[model samples]
Target: MEKRNKILNIEQIHTYYGVSHVIQGLSMYIEEQETVSILGRNGVGKTTTLRSIMGLTPPQSGTINIDGIDTSRWQPHKISKIGVAYVPAERHIFPGLTVEENLKLAARPGNGKDAWTFERVCDHFPVLAERTNQDGATLSGGEQQMLAISRALISNPRIIIMDEPSQGLSPLLVQMITDVVLKFCIKSGITMLIVEQNYRMALKVATRHYLMDTKGEIVKVASTRELVDDPEIIQSHLSV
Candidate 1:
């Protein structure tokens, strides 16, 4: 494979919540069109890492670079505007609004011919197209996840960072989401960073995996093939 340009970079990032340090000198990078995942059991600061990148929680120390620009102190909206999108596990779609309305609110027009338009996203997520007229809160958990992902795509972001996308779904829905995300990585060429407690789903979706320790640090970084070759890392790091 040819080398791709870097899109997101984190160097020794140390983030905090009221003086309680969560991310401890962590660093990583995502290249253009790469699918990267951070894997850990619950409460290992996986969400905080995404928050730090999104500027919802800025790092007190270290630097965050997005597309060669320093965004360590930038606000969340500004970070979002500059080609980064986040899909929180909470799936905060507007409950009272129709699915189409939720999508239109977040859409950003692009001059490129291949920009992710509403119709194109609908083609990818037919279930959301079916629920276009339905209220966001009225859809099943799986449909809402698809909507959240579609909304991000409609924005035409350079990279999409998802936090625990499989959190509240059943096994069937998890598999469905897994398939959707896998398709996105394989076909869309959209860069992705997934923070997942579901290591199985992450293993199937991400090309590279950052395994986190209980101390809120990356204990090991493994390629998907490496982890698959040695499944015991899952039992050691990701098992409950």
Candidate 2:
């Protein structure tokens, strides 16, 4: 049997927002080329888990390892240097800048021939190519989401972490975004750790799912087959 390479690992993380306890002893991991999703009702520390992994909100305890190196004490930029990229839910593009400017601003030269070059990413997202001169904030919600995701890919990360890629989009747009992510997982083999409210979309793209409860801990873990075979799991934990 082939060995699995862990791209990201979290063990017993506890994070807090000004003494308000959250992310109590949450632990999870993603292997290389794996796509994992964390699902739950709102305000259940899903985003906080992603934040903890990225070093945005450092865990008060436990360890975070990326590519086998402990990064619990690293800064967000330092984490990015070690091949972790993030596409936050807010779609934080510079409103005053053009699409081209935004991509260039976040660009870190990737590896080798198949690396995600400016032309390559633009080719992957022709809508962005056509609107290169347009200010980021002026674009429609779907377009902005595309730009946000493109920014992450252009960095050519070992793993990409996304928070609510489907939030605030229409059903049609949500499906479109889902298709984009599915393609990334199939073609690029990019590892992903996603926190999403749209479990249907998440399940479609993720090979594994984590069911987080109100207490900020993982109560259940399932493979796509396991969860699909047992709809009751979704209904019991994920349903509102």
Candidate 3:
């Protein structure tokens, strides 16, 4: 088999919030076009891991490389400019702007070959298209989540970092988000690093899973199929 290039690499990263030590020597890598997930209970630094990668909270030590460039110290906008898009748990859309405006404002010009155009994003997310003129604050939670993802896609990112994409939604909406990831992202060859509390939804979209311990260390890394078959592993690491 051919070896795939590493699109994102995190080596021995330690992050802190003021005096609170969060991530402790965490290291992981995602190969090109692979959808990898970090799964753990609440407050396990899964979101911190994504934030560290995107330079939202730069690791005090260690290194992060994106597309062969060292981005450990880069600012958030600089990181985004280099083809990394982040969808946070907050769903931070501009409440005053229409859905179409939100997507348009996030778009960046892509290389002609694989560019994700406004029309293309709307096509993939038809609900966003239907609500083009609606203000972001007026949309339902699921619609807001869809808009968030659509905004990320509009930026034409090579990799997308999603933190808890399935949180606080109906089961039907969770399934819809899963389908969007599988059908639109996976098929489009977009590399995704997802931090999810919903293990079932994460398993449905990701090929590999990394389970984090309470101290913010990776305790287990396994193929999704292997982990799925071993209820003991899931129970031991992820169960409440």
Go through the candidates in order and give each one's C-alpha lDDT: 0.89, 0.89, 0.90
Predicted structure with the largest lDDT when compared to the true one: 3
lDDT of 1 at 116: 80
Query: Scored by Cα lDDT, where does model 3 land?
Result: 0.90
Give me the overall lDDT of model 1.
Answer: 0.89
lDDT of 3 by residue, 1-68 (tens): 99999998888989999988899999899999999999999899998998899899999998998988
User: Candidate 1, which segments miss by more than 4 Å at Cα?
Assistant: none
Clashing pairs in 2: none
In candidate 1, what residue range of length 10 has the lowest lDDT sum?
181-190
Candidate 2, residue 95: Cα displacement in angstroms equals 0.9
Native-structure RMSD, model 2? 1.1
Quote the lDDT for 64 in model 2.
93
Look at candidate 2 and tell me the lDDT of residue 155.
Answer: 88
Ranking by lDDT: 3, 1, 2
